[model samples]
Target: MKIDWAALGSVFGISLLITVALVALFTLGIVGLSRRERAAAQGDTAAVAVTGAYACFAACAAAVGYGIYLIVA
Candidate 1:
């Protein structure tokens, strides 16, 4: 059997990028929540921070759900 080196490399590249993106997104969510806590301690309204944190979490969840769906289907 012949190995399809180009296809293998392409899949590897895509997977690597997606993994990095997901990790970065999760990290941003954590950082956003941490910033929100700091802002609260300083008595500042963390409206933007709160929104950002939630949005990041939601996106991560959606991505995970979609991956599961793809696997199942």
Candidate 2:
């Protein structure tokens, strides 16, 4: 049997890129939370930071859900 090396490489590359992007997105969310905490400690409003963090988390969740859907369907 012949193996499709190019297809295998393409999948591997895409997977690695997506994995890194998701991790980075999650990290941004964590950073936003940290900023919010710091702002709160200084008696400042952190509405934007909190909102941004939640948005990041939501996007990450959506991406994961889509991936699962792809696998199942």
Candidate 3:
């Protein structure tokens, strides 16, 4: 089968962007979680927003990987 280089490149680029964004968001969530955990331990009122952020990041990252796999295969 002939490979469409342009389309492959576009898919790869999009996947890379998504992966990077997910990682950045996950890192931010981790930082926020650390802060929130500390606050909670100190008996402060910090709602658990980071957990949802982390879950979303995981889903996004998995989707990006799946897209990359589809493009490659």
lDDT of each: 0.93, 0.96, 0.77
TM-score-based ranking: 2, 1, 3
lDDT of 2 by residue, 1-73 (tens): 9999999999999999999999999998999999999998999988888899999999999999999999999
Off by over 4 Å in 2: none
lDDT of 1 by residue, 1-73 (tens): 9999999999999999999999999999999999989998999988887899899999999999999999999
Candidate 2 or 1, higher TM-score? 2
Q: Which stretches of candidate 1 lie above 4 Å from their native place? A: none
lDDT of 3 by residue, 1-73 (tens): 8999999999899878876887777777677678778888899955666666577667767877887898899
Residue 60 CA displacement from its true place in model 3, Å: 4.4
* TM-score of every candidate relative to the true structure: 0.94, 0.96, 0.55
Q: Judging by lDDT against the true structure, name the best candidate.
A: 2
> Would you list the clashing residue pairs of candidate 2?
none
